[model samples]
Target: MRNYFIFVIVVFVSLSSSAQHTIKNTINNVELITVKDSKFFKGDKPYYFIGANYWYGPLIGAKNGGDRARLLKELDLMKAQGIDNLRILVGAEGDGGDSRVHPALQYEQGKYNNELLDGLDFLMAEMRKRNMYAVLYLNNNWIWSGGMSQYLEWNGYGTVPNPFLPDYSWDDYLNYTKQFHSCIPCKEAFYKHVKFIMERTNAYTNIKYINDNAIMSWQVANEPRVLISPDHETAFADWLNKTVDLIESLDSVHLISTGAEGKASYLQDIAMYQRLHSNKNIDYLTMHMWPKNWGWYSINNEKTSTITSIQNANAYLDEHILVAQKMKKPIVMSEFGFPREKESLNPTSSITNRDNFYKAVIDRITQSKVEKGVLAGLNFWGFAGFAKTNSENGKWLHGDDFTADPPQEPQGLNSVFASDITTLKLIKDANLLLIE
Candidate 1:
């Protein structure tokens, strides 16, 4: 009788331990991406990717409220083409309706819409199924997503005071966006949103976000900048340091990035840019190239303008590459795109200039890979997939279906659709070399 009781107790203890081990394995099923010697790694292999800015992915993947069918098709499409990384906006804030960036996940402070969060879960779950990774930006520096400006308005500030106004100056917009760095209440509100998101569980997989490997990194904001303001620049440095540390503490598994628009954050000051990224918590570097926005191209003079734009782009890439190499960190051209010939948004329009532009960028990346340089990857401006706008020749307006085009840009501009075979091939060919 004594031997029988002892045997039963041993069996029970072994079963309990086995159960615990199973639960742990189930909760942490995915492999986390790691960084070493300035390069990203998955296990022992270098992690290089052909990615796209599917910023509207979560919105389209939301259950009942979004277009899930399209989301699945798009993911499958990207997977088929060997695209492996997706950069998406986790959520947007504001009381603005579809007139602004549709599907504001957190319109009021502390008031989150679970539907959107569930949508994000669905997106991540689908990406996991496809073996794709995501880089999610937590906030936007611009009002397109009801970003810093909206946060201020929520705190009793009046209008955004944007420079786009006929009478207002650009300095006004710069100063307005700059205010966010120092506003303690605003920062606290933003932090709450971050914590809430970090702590939330994915509805589909039942896996906590911190443990989910679908996410590659958490970007602090989209194109955050100090915009040449001395005081604001100082404050932003502090904010970046603290914010990255906070994210690191919250989720030690994933990487953290500033989501800065490269030299734009430091007003094209290379030294300042380097200093900003020197923080130990900042895992890698990012930069963006906008020939149109920076006045390197003109719509009226297509051939000449495009040539100049491409030249300028190459120079920009070269400079950024030197900077990244000096810092000994991998760099991603997170955003780069050119409009169709003559800046046309027409689906059937010629992409001669755009194609050449993409090829140039890809060639640089491929060369860098062969030489073991610092440039690691490139994510074009966006992927619109099958979504379309109501008007072919106008800015985005309310009542039109939301495409990949953000609210701030003209409809259909910079959207890489499934029909863009040439562009797709460029991406695929470049991706194949990296994977091989």
Candidate 2:
């Protein structure tokens, strides 16, 4: 009798485990992510991920002349820390510059560097191996990444109204990029690039790009903005809607979203934020927060400024959450970070304030998750794991291994690495508890 009972128990347990595995596979195999009551769903399971922006994942994962060792190690580290999603750049358009990643992918009209595309293929293949998902931005709104201004220049527009220029102010740069909304030829070239990426088959995985489950979403651009121009508002809407439609037609298996920095819309009009994302085809909403850019924090004075920045950040998140709730869609805080204490970039520098800020953000997300709120995901500004500045001044020089820190910013400014023990622990703990 005892032997019979033992066999029965073992059989029951095995059956239960098998059932769970089937359910997970079914969810993971879904063609497109669907929405259900403000939560993102893969089949029947609620989907959430603790993610990071590894914008250079493709470059590092490329098979031909790519950093395979570093890519493998970083992906291993990220998975070990409970990170399941990564937001990476698909590719950038236009020519390279002194302060940016040289030998860009799409430097000329309809021309591409096959090396970078292979890099993205390797990235997706490896992410699939780790059960990781990717949010691939198709373009960038900033100049550092050979973004929109490059497209404008490609169309015989005399100068790019260069943002990095000493004479140009920040607003001027934004206004210049806003023109990308109306540039017909520039928009057409961008669509071509998108189709090229979406239609390709992964060399490493033997899976078509659209069929690959590793891709979670295709973002239109990084933090696309309308600026203060009234005409550009109409233009931005047209561009966003058209782009989402184009992606949907090309690949219905994957999800699509706009990389808009919430509430910072050219007009700061909350209605525009709501209206822009109301499109049926847009899978989810994304928002980015920059305490330093918004003037809520000062890099020079970490102590007092960090305190105010945290407060401002809290309010900013809450506001976006309310908007997401109203729209009845899942939202991700796709970007948020603080400079090191005193804004130091050294590997050994203290991240005390930075850790505190992360804790606050995680705690809020946790609270929202518990409440069943609209916030479903969080991908901090970057994860630079082990990469350091190549230059003595702690700046990113040409030929340095690409880090999560973009060229527009100082190297190591917001990168969270393995050495950040306290911060890593907080992130891991949050990831473990915040999901079902």
Candidate 3:
């Protein structure tokens, strides 16, 4: 029975070790290539990405209400319509962005803390079960408690509002972040928090939906530090190099990309940070827009569409596609949502008008060869059912109606969900698309 005892011991040890992950397969060689003839890689496969950008549970504090089971059911509903991928944020928050330990794996941060990663694991696993893919957001735009810090901050948008408490100078922000208890990317916390999680995510998981290369790609940071100091080129390039280096050091076999909003800081303005970061290792490209929102930057986009706003966005899209094509990286319109009623910012087009915009954008993207090749997918902003999470802006940028409370609409404008999304097939394919 001594032999039987040895066998039992080995079995127990194996089962316990399985809980911790380690990379099983990695690329033998790596290359920095500018994608050409994206179709060249996937013969007649017609790889496509059609989905939505939804809130991340960690920051949103989602206890249940449509967590994974709900998301999976939605995906099933969409499959009948042809939409396939979903974008979820697995960002630089709490301990994830820190350099010490990922609060995702740690249970002590907050009840809502570990809940974030658990949600992701479930979502990713469900995606695999359903043969769907997800784009994981790595940063956010929300400010924190008593304005202490922001959990979910978006592209360059958050900084403009100076969301965080004590609106910090870029320098002060950096200094404060390094010493802050949470994980903040590029801060001392980043190395420990983000790096640790990156390593873990790279490890073998049965979530083949993402790992099968079926998933879209990883977005390094949201619209972030627009003008990287020192030098945009050096700063962004260094940032990209370090972030991806750490990610690949552990999980090297997957494709990487960014969900930047196509702004000078996010996607365009090659001399700016986005290009700097993207040029090095980004495998695909994605963007977000609100030409109406351009006023803040002094780029006034009159909402008179002979459909000009979406057109301008598409123009920017073209620029990005060319850039990605030049770099051999494909493109994904990962986050593009226009409002029905045009406001000064976060303009929401009318439900009817917005549908027109979606159609135009989709047609333009799908019809071009150079642009199409680079496009492995597209996911619109938001999924539904969580709109109640915040009656504040539930389901739409302008609230639920399109009356420009303007002249006096702090909540600028509102749009109807059903009618607006009716014309956009993406919504039908995936009902989650129209969520506020």
Candidate that would win on lDDT = 1
Cα displacement (Å) at residue 197, model 3: 2.8
- Give the C-alpha lDDT of model 2: 0.81
Residue range 166-282, candidate 3, lDDT tens digits: 555645554332222233432334445555445444222443322344344555655544443343434445555676666556455556664566655533465452445454455
lDDT of each: 0.82, 0.81, 0.46
lDDT of 2 at 314: 86
Q: Candidate 2, which ten residues in sequence have the lowest lDDT sum?
A: 25-34
- Give me the runs in candidate 2 sitting further than 4 Å from their true place: 1-33
Each model's TM-score? 0.94, 0.90, 0.64
Per-candidate count of clashing residue pairs (backbone under 3 Å): 0, 1, 45
Distance from true location, Cα of 394 in model 2, Å: 2.4
Assess the local accuracy of residue 348 in candidate 1 as a C-alpha lDDT between 0 and 100: 85
- What digit string (tens of lDDT, one per residue) describes model 2 on residues 53-141? 99988777766767889899999988988898899997666656747665577878788888888888888878888888899999888
Per-residue accuracy of model 1 over 1-436 as CA lDDT, tens digit each: 9999999999999999999999887655655677888888876788777789899888888786688998999999888888888999976888654356766888787788778888899999999888788899998887778888778878876777755457667777777777888888888888888898888888888888888887888999999887655556689888778888899999987988888778876878878889889988788899998888889878888788888988998888888888888888888988887888776778788998889888988888888778767788788888888877644664676535566677767777778888889999999888999888
For candidate 2, the per-residue lDDT at 211 reads: 79
Return the lDDT, model 3, position 352: 53
lDDT of 1: 0.82
TM-score winner between candidates 1 and 2: 1
